[model samples]
Target: MENKDKTDWRFKVANREALIGCGLALLNFVWWFGFAYGMGSRPVEEYSYILGMPDWFFYSCVVGFLLITALVIFVVKVFFKEVPFEEEEELR
Candidate 1:
């Protein structure tokens, strides 16, 4: 194929993967910062300990969110290679 077509395909694939990564990161951020914290009125200290753990257990949530997002992004980049529109016909 032409060199321009090859370049365009590479560009499109890169953009598609980047978009996916950004979306996942945003979702993680919202879940951890918005849903978890927004609903809570008082400080974590006001709550009783759970199973000997402190009420301010939100640090774990932050770390877990980061780890999960990293794994998801890695999996998306490794297993999901995007195809250009022109190549769709070849799949048939």
Candidate 2:
């Protein structure tokens, strides 16, 4: 009797995908935080605008959302693999 769970390849794929997801999430957060705090620390009177939006808000919220969305789509198409959920029977 061998353990099938330990030998499952899907687990490996799932874990790799999970780590990639976490990494992307962290990257998005860092980007948002850096832009929001770094550019927004100045006084409101000194704030700059881009396309009718504040610089910090434009870059941190709008741009970051679009960038992360594209990155997630790329990652899913490139790095993520499709694994079947049904249990496969062992061959005798």
lDDT of 2 by residue, 27-76 (tens): 99999999999999999999999999999999999999999999999999
lDDT of 1 at 22: 82
Off by over 4 Å in 1: 1-7, 43-48, 51-79, 82-92
Q: After superposition, how far is residue 3 of candidate 1 from its true place, in Å?
A: 9.9
True-structure lDDT of candidate 1? 0.63
Q: What are the per-residue Cα lDDT tens digits for candidate 1 across 40-92?
A: 55576575554675433453375546776687968776866856556334333
Q: Give the residue spans of candidate 2 off by over 4 A.
A: 1-6
Error of 2 at 92 (Å): 2.5
For each candidate in turn, give its C-alpha RMSD to the true structure in angstroms: 7.3, 1.8
The TM-score that candidate 1 achieves is: 0.51
Task: Give candidate 2's TM-score.
Answer: 0.92
